[model samples]
Target: MLEKNHILTPEKWVKLHADYLYNYTISRINNHEISKDLVQETFFAALNAMKNFEGKASERTWLIAILKRKIIDYYRKINSIKGKAEVRMNFYDDGEHAGEWIEERVPSSWVSEVEKDIENRELGNALEKCISALPEKYEIVFRMKTIEELETEEICKELDISSSNLWVIIHRARLQLRKCMEDNWFKK
Candidate 1:
């Protein structure tokens, strides 16, 4: 059986997906401890059930799906005491001023220099600091989905979270990152 169907290689794939898992959990939920645990859980789950893995989607995508589910289960298990109803992604209310969101300001003179800095060192350091400052869950989720490029369904499954929760987390993560980048990297 092992020789005839030797498709199980979970370890080889874990590294590829760790960054994805990290970002998804951190960015979406803003919980570092949970995100770290979830990343571990995703790899273990993938390894234990390697034989059952379907090749319909990319390997990363499949892992992400599993991780997302794990996250939801975690939240439900922990928060069940409150008995709150599960809803689709929990969106943040737009600012009370109510005008459509406006584009951020960009400096005409510094674009090229800033781009070079980001490619080299300064920008990277700033980004690292900003990401580290985010709540753990949001950081993980954003990193996974945005930087690592996992699909939403994949993330949801991997984390055991609802689509609604995923969406809300993603939105909030992006908003936070945008603000951070604007303040730290763009303005100064």
Candidate 2:
């Protein structure tokens, strides 16, 4: 008993939805390889669970849903307890607040973990928009040092910049990130 409005068409998945899925993955993951892997994984998972499809959603929408879960799982795997470095260290050493992301400095005493997951999604989108709005260099360095949690020396050497220059760039990037988060996320 399936709905006539929607049907599972697994054979056409690649041609019909590959590009759309890849584009979505790349924008969120920021790593081409990981995004590709997630897209492929989504296809596999959907195939295995195809029997469970109720035809409630179009193939594309259902695929995107699976892809979103895959993306979330990827991030969770990278940010696990063993990946403590993934957490951005606080740059400031003040009397009050010692360390955390520049995004956290915006005073979000309102957002509790007990809140709805939808709120978190909106916040993530806003943060992502702010991050993408950053200047190219800023965005790259910020992701490398903050999001990717690469070592200071590693990032500096890879980017072919002096340690001091890297720090300057990171500081400026954090400042801009804070401002952007405040304006875009907090205001919402």
Return the TM-score for each candidate structure. 0.48, 0.49
Candidate 2 lDDT tens digits, 1-188: 85477888889999999999998776546778888888999999999999989987889999998987786566545534363323234456555545644455544543454345446777788777877776555566678787778798976655556789878767867777776776665544
Quote model 1's TM-score: 0.48
Model 2 scores what on Cα lDDT? 0.72
* Weakest 10 consecutive residues of candidate 1 by summed lDDT: 83-92
lDDT of 1 by residue, 15-90 (tens): 6778878986776566678789989988888888777876656777778878867877775665454424322222
Error of 2 at 127 (Å): 16
Residue 77 accuracy (lDDT) in model 1: 63
lDDT of each: 0.68, 0.72
RMSD of each: 8.5, 14.5
Candidate 2's TM-score: 0.49
Q: After superposition, how far is residue 6 of candidate 2 from its true place, in Å?
A: 1.1
